[model samples]
Target: MSGGGSWRFECKFCNTKYVGAHNRVVSHLLKDGGKGVKVCPKVTPQQLANMSKLLNDCKERVKNAAPKSVPLPSSLRNAATSSLDYDMSFTCSNPTSSEVGLKKRKGMGTALEKAFQNNSKEQCDGEIARMFYIGGLSFNLARNPHYRRSYVRASNIPGYVLPGYNALRTTLLQKERKNIELHLQPIKDSWKAKGVSICSDGWSDPQRRPIINLIVANTNGPMMLRAVNSQGEVKSGEMIAELIIECIKEVGHENVVQIITDNASNCVKAGALISAKYHVIFWTPCVVHTLNLVVKNICAPSLQTRNNDDVYDACKWIRPLADDVSLIKNFIMNHGMRLVMFTEHCNLKLLTVASTRFASTLVMFKSLRK
Candidate 1:
């Protein structure tokens, strides 16, 4: 389509010239008894009415809906706010990953008109910048598809009213959820045949509150189910088992094959409870976590009986050695000059064994061996 700002337009149907674009283009297509622009001679009555209703709705929304404040899609807000920041919560519905960055618009009538459009877009960009600054919203939000699309839609309407806060949180939120659910229908439909696995893991957010994340997966791929905050409530085997049962019911018991969790006793108990409740399904420990545990055990110092004075464990030196390695890694990484000197001596950086993941000790040992 040519630029909406063009003062000249040729009607494709009749090859007739018009003085404006956009609304005028719309005005030209449907018969309105020549209200300063000739209506399309070929347009059916039903088509004219439909076009008029669309235009009327566009005009009415600005007058009727502008006073209320509503939120943008949670795909942008929740993803930027909680998901990627703490690195546990996953992006599920309404992903902002679909955003396509803006580009220079095409099909301009002249340099003067193009300059005007460019300047207008720059002003809009200024408003977006101001919005981020004033609201303390993430700059990453601009990357969302809706960020530009909502503005483009608003611009097309003469006096388009923005949705209210109540509408955004209530009506529009529900509407968006339904839309996203429709997109997820294919995955939901595959649940029965393939038998999905229910996987969960624990995390702590920035506030340090515990979170239990759930995801459902088959051969297709993983889909995040939910993230529950276990703040005030006690996180026990029974408590976690309830959550698993709830999820099983939601996904349908027939569709669930197994539940996967860490090797913690409580989680093991939870799995047992789930297995007992749903006879068709079973519980299993995460394979990676299990292997990590094996690595951690292998790296531990050998055990010895305190009653035997003559007995000396073969791995008595290992405990102190691992501790010394950890201390050295920390010291080198914390100091700038020490790190520089260490890097000068060895090209490979020392790896710190994270207590969170047991396999990190193996990685640390590998670095030391180099």
Candidate 2:
């Protein structure tokens, strides 16, 4: 019991000592190590009660002696208190009207009593109109008589002004576009000295109308130069080369450093033509598209496989697995019930393979395996 400097308690009956905190000492007295050891007859009711009381007193002293938190600054405290008062004032402008109604109705208050009461209905309505514009809602929604009435009714306030369709279309839209153009002017000017790279890509919409987009990239960022509808015209290498040359003229031949396009035969020929036309500008294929082609080639099955060739047949297994993965993705995505079941059973969402990029197939398979 006296081996260490810390206090220790000894069981007088068995002479077993416990050293450490007072909780250990209390446990020894109450349980006497349970059935593993005999109870100490020397621990009386009075002694147990005294020890319990002392332990509680020590805890209370600790609780009371903790450092009190510093109060908030007087300015902040006053501001917080005033905010609550302001909210109450808005809600209780006519307290007598409510109390008189309460007496007449006998505890059946009107439902309108719980509604938000505000003096700034005009400001709130203006904010709603701004949000509608920012959210890209159709301008015709404002002109609809029923929708306008419904919106006003939902606010439960009078004289809430909604933005007019004509004003939004003619005035506000033009002003916003003008402001954006003003901001973009400085960015365009900064790209002149450092030179820019031009990237072009062509794709067809769901209706099969061909569209070509041109983008210019510089130290600042990429900016769309133009998007043209090919209008069912032939997109030969000469046509594409002409389009690139026209964009370079607009961007200034001196300010252009390079042109990048996908590795299609027509695009490659177009790039070569552009390089020949402009001696200073270099032409290169898109690195991402080239790498994707490499992956596609590696995964393609050997077309010249002969019968009884085990290695060639084994190498062809990847094509079927890739196809199966695509099929499963399409099946689940095309059917709502199957999609829900797949989500519940697998706990993973299916990813679609991108037809334009072969790398997407590899990623889709990896996610399916996971």
Candidate 3:
């Protein structure tokens, strides 16, 4: 309250008193730089003390009500710990291609400029490590284990290594296999130029898995090797024919002069079709196999019994022993004339068996000789 009409005293803490008219009273009350002042008449000491205490309590309440303090973890020792001033990144005012090498990081979440804002050495190293660990696997950066080691070690990112390794190895294997196939194409082409022969037989391996091998020979020379047709599926004659045709086309049909094989009906039919289409002759079976066939037919019954006993024993003994040059030489040294006669006789028999078409003669000779 003031002495003037409809006026108020101003509290120094809150400058919310009447503006114009209360100026004089405000000045009088706060004469010393707006500090609180007191004026009273017939006032007791107890009353003055009570008034001062009330004013002090009001001031204290206002101070306490200003803003509530945020509770923090007890583990935080410093009160200023809550005032975390985030470090600011510096921007390059001008940058050139020479300063930063040109390469696009496609799947990277942030651009190099953003990742390494001011191009500090530490920041640049961090960015590179991240790129290698995250982008390397996908972009072929971590294809080598050594690169992966360097990246992981530099980045201190052990967690990212395994996934990156798997990605890198898978891509590498795929690439290596593709390259190998490309290199083998030249060998296939060479074989085609010289003409290839086919050797087809149905056989089972130790696991009883039926598979066929297609062998090719040089029409010009004695070089022969297996045919590696990755796309071949040999089920029937037509399927086999397709493989032959593909090989012919690869090397050229004229280069493929002949396909030498046995008289298996399917084999014969397949050869006939190939020869007809490619204008290549199919040669007859080997003479050695033909002799074996003649012998098998001749003594089917009698030789079957003998083959179980004497003939099998004689063959088991003679073939391997005679085939050994040292043994033959030793025999010649011991019985010179007789050994020479025997050698001549064996050669004559072999020639006769190879040339003759009679099955009975081979059987009679086998029985007489043994």
Candidate 4:
């Protein structure tokens, strides 16, 4: 049954039983251990030697057989090794490829580690900074890197010493404005192109410092953007007049046509100059501005004659009723289609009032009502 708790098997020919440890069957057969389970317990030693020799011959064949070798060029092999080392050090480390034990580690230094150590600190820092700058620039120009990588590259180190592209843009704009007046030299003999149309508008920066842009439609299509003085006490009349004259001089005074601007008083004063100097007409304020003013007037509470008292009272009424979130939500849910129709009509009216406003905004507002 069992020898040392190992199950025993009998040989069919010799009727001999043998027992051994687990998984020892295959190896024990190849060795002389299989002789114990032979049918004949008194088998000749010569026969046993012949069986052992046959097993040994089979093992030699297996061991001596040539394995398939992957063909690789020497150069390619070296390059692949270098790439693998780089990946293992900087990119990734596979558990199977990791070095083991202290026996083979006697002064066996990594080539990559040695190269890194050989590099000067300043050189490494500069290289890192350069990589960051390059990565950031490539991301902005082509948007190749992901958002995180782009941010990392842009914010890295001494490479990004400048505030940002936005700051550089603003600086460039300021510099251009100072020297732009000189660039407005009148075109030679361009007085024969009839009247010129001028477009002017004042815009305040984030800091609330106003800058006026004066664009003139000369015989040629569009002229450069010129700046108006915004330093001293802000005077609407003075600002408009200065902008008009500058545009007029850019395009010859004789060729001066109508000047267009929003309904700002200063713009009105500026427009009036072209009419006075060159007999050019001052048209009504810009259509977009007129539409905004019309809307404001329609909504104004001062139309009731009580002025501030009526305005405050109207605000108190509207804020509580129309501004109620739950009421608005309910109305939208119940009469959403009707609200969309009404909004569409309102947008059409607005479009007719200012033809320049984007239709997409109208559609957007219609959806928001729902």
Best by TM-score: 1
Instruction: For candidate 2, write residues 1-370 as lDDT tens digits.
Output: 4546656667674688656555556566765464334445577798778867887898899999997533221211122255333222323335455445653565323455335322245335545565677689887877989877877686796767756999899898999989988988876897778899999998887888889999999889888888889986888899999999999999899999999999899998999899999999989899988888767754664554544377566567777888888887888899999888888889767888777866777888889989
Candidate 2 residue pairs in backbone clash: none
TM-score, structure 1 vs. true: 0.57
lDDT values, one for every candidate:
0.76, 0.74, 0.52, 0.54
TM-scores, all candidates, are 0.57, 0.54, 0.31, 0.39
> Ranking under lDDT, best-scoring first?
1, 2, 4, 3
Superior candidate under lDDT, 1 versus 3: 1
**lDDT comparing candidate 3 with the true structure:** 0.52
lDDT of 1 by residue, 99-207 (tens): 2111122333357755676534644565566679878999889789998898889989998899998999999999999999899989998998888999999999999
lDDT of 1 at 10: 82
In model 4, the number of clashes is: 5
Better of 1 and 3 by TM-score: 1
User: Distance from true position, residue 254, model 3, in Å?
Assistant: 2.3
List residue ranges in candidate 1 displaced over 4 A.
Answer: 1-114, 117-122, 145-158, 161-164, 302-322, 333-352, 364-370
Q: Name the better of 3 and 4 by TM-score.
A: 4
| Model 2 Cα RMSD, 1 decimal | 31.3
